[model samples]
Target: MLKKQKVSLVVLTLLLLLNIVGILNSTQYLLKILFSYFVLIIAITFLPFLRQKINYSYKLQEILFGLPMILPIFLFKLKTISFAIGKLKHFEIFLIYLLFLAVVLLLLHHKDYRMKSSSPFIKLSISKKEVFLTILGMVYSIFTEEMYFRFFILSELEDYSYYLKIVFLVFSSFLFVGAHYLNKWAASMFTYKNYISQFILSMLSGNIFLVTNSLFYSLILHIAYNFPEIWLILKRLKYQQLHYENDGAFFDDY
Candidate 1:
């Protein structure tokens, strides 16, 4: 393996091992700092010093510029973002997102459907602005992940036999899905739909990369897969906020 490939593989493998230990012991302390972790990944992965002179098709060489998105987390407590929900198409698109979420939920975890219940903790746990930032952060992380698991890994193995490349891709995709299991910070996040989404993404991302040789399409797929979880998050938060305003209760359900 090349020096860079060795570094990438070791780093990802160490993370997987850490998550495995976390799963066994139920330690998610790292989960709280995941935003910072993603920031670091985006920075180091694209940094010229840590990587070789490999040109990328996606042109993400300057990803450090996006680190400023974290400023909202530390500097501001923005209550509202306009979210610009006043438009007609915005509602239409939101409805589409809801429809998609419903279909997936029914198909995957229909037996244990408990979405009707509101989460009181969520009202105080996160805010609308944070959720919006999370959505953007999610997008950036998706791109970063696909770039690592698809483009960089596969590219490093390009000199190997085609069959060997397939094997590595399959293994890498497995690691990718397994990482999602480590990201199970909430019950809603680890639903059957979420697991299935990860599995499908693990397979499809590799196939897409193999066929198209670009992370752009796989990045889109990853984001699309997370839509259900994202919707549920927003739903609970919106519910809590409305109740908070109308009832003036301390930490009531959303």
Candidate 2:
């Protein structure tokens, strides 16, 4: 990037960060999305590569491919796994499956982030069924975000100088971390200590897209890296829900 471009990029990166942080207190999901898109619109106007009309035909094709996954989310909402399990034995089968998932998640997050809570930003007193639903919802979000960042955001910087792309890479990584702060679990999830892993994971997803030019590869990585944090969030919700239930089953190992 030219010296002036570098300076301007710094200013825009800060503006974008501020825009993201502005949604920190917002609880309405749809409105936060609108505000972020508004910022992106303003950003593209100043960004030379983005000043031209963007070809969203690619986005349309992606949505088509994503439909197979989208259908299951709706099915889960209609009739969840928790709804089918009746006996303790059945629940054990479910729990065993989740344990396998937990093993994969542990490989992703390591064990250090299991710190005791500093109180949540907002508590969700949710149930087993709700936990599955929330995770299904996160699956949808992972798809949306991978499309937005690895696909759309990176496309905006195509052919830009390598240094500028790296800057945007870091900026995009922070955007992922900023998203956690926007969550109800923010108080614990967005602590600066976790930023290192989050950045590495974000960069890994971003760089993989650049290498393969395929959202499919990057999307899977995003899900793999994020599943552990999602598990932690679900566990915390369960932990908080226990406060309201006299007979809540406790899983001591999480």
Candidate 3:
């Protein structure tokens, strides 16, 4: 087993609050700061120069250091009460997600679990604004997802049998992707392929995130994926609200 830090109850509580507040505000500032910190942590992990300079005895010190920074994002996502209502109204979709996750778990256990690289595609240049937004999303994903699934769920499920641990790991991964799919499907932002890809990606990503004991890389990738789409959605909502208010004002004038 990797040398692990026993996170204190006080620390965990604080981390949860930080992650939740950051996401709830939908602000990019904290996100950017988190991504920057993630990069720093990643660098310190791989670079001997930085590693030697730091006064830490633990191999996974970066993970612990990041917890306080990451907690808010986790708390922010859970702060919303939408999940309670959605699960009630969209029971079929919910069941389908669970079923699909079971299939993914079975597939993972099969011999063909190795990853295959996709064909090379043209890449877009990263704009400053895009970079900024992605960093935000990265912060949000890293803190919130890691805390909820890897830390909170895993810690709580520790009492289960070894077989159950495996099952929980697989199911937790599925639930993570399924949650995204349900929300994205309702928002009309995600494709069927997108959900499938994300599910696979989440499984792989979760393993790496836990293994490295650093949520930084996972945060970067998620934020990069989510930033553009979320920005567009917010802009659209703002535009519609403005249009509606102006129309109301015009009627009043007439």
Candidate 4:
């Protein structure tokens, strides 16, 4: 496991180097290499094909991916650091509410993200209080991360056509998944059902951002993307209660 993890780290480092140089060179070959690296990370980390067990490889990938994901946001925050930090203006409040509504709808429809009996994210001791806390943490974590990745980063890329924007969103999400592949490889794998769902969702959200000229919608969608985890926690809490009352009838035969 340790050897496999070391190799994984090496691969991650090489990919980062290739990505940095490739971004600067802007050559097709470099882009191809970077893309391949991203795919490899996805396969080895997420797909069962690899037969390699590395301790918390997915979690490590999340941290690794998260750094690059957060960098653009950090730069934006720095650029705006000296700006006013006053009370919310009317327009700002309206935008916030709109974002919130989108989030609610997005969460309601998101299915794969929800916890299932066999999902890795579901733990045994979940309670209502823990569910709420996890939901809050997941929302905040995804919101800040999305603000940087989807909203701010997309804003940086030139969106000359809807096609270009779509390309960027898919590519960005690909990288986004790659960076955090360690934590959620299932969602990151291009071949996974959830991956396809997220890809389509991201493409739609990107187009919506372009059409509406509103970053608020994108922000809400980003937060809503995390609804699956929230749903899972809540489900676990309810299931625990029911199971307790039922005297383990569900598992008693086993």
**Residue-wise lDDT of candidate 3 within 73-137, one digit each (tens)?**
45444322111222232444334444554465445432322211111211222333444454455
Better of 2 and 3 by lDDT: 2
Instruction: State the lDDT at 115 in candidate 2.
Output: 43
Candidate 1 C-alpha error for residue 49, in Å: 28
lDDT of 4 by residue, 1-254 (tens): 23444466577667667667764565443344354444445544444333345445644433544444455445435223111223346346546544654554455544534335457545475555556556766655665455455555465444357676676777766655544444433434434544544554566555555444455556566656555556667777776786655333332335
Off by over 4 Å in 2: 1-109, 112-128, 182-185, 229-254
lDDT leaderboard ranking: 2, 1, 4, 3
The Cα RMSD of model 3 versus the native structure comes to 20.8
For every candidate, C-alpha RMSD to the true structure in Å:
15.3, 16.1, 20.8, 9.2
Q: Estimated TM-score per prediction?
A: 0.47, 0.44, 0.35, 0.51
Whole-model Cα lDDT per candidate?
0.53, 0.53, 0.44, 0.52
lDDT preference between candidates 1 and 3, better one: 1
How high is the lDDT of residue 99 in model 3?
Answer: 53
| Model 2 Cα shift for residue 220 (angstroms) | 1.2
Candidate 1's TM-score: 0.47
Candidate 2 accuracy as lDDT: 0.53
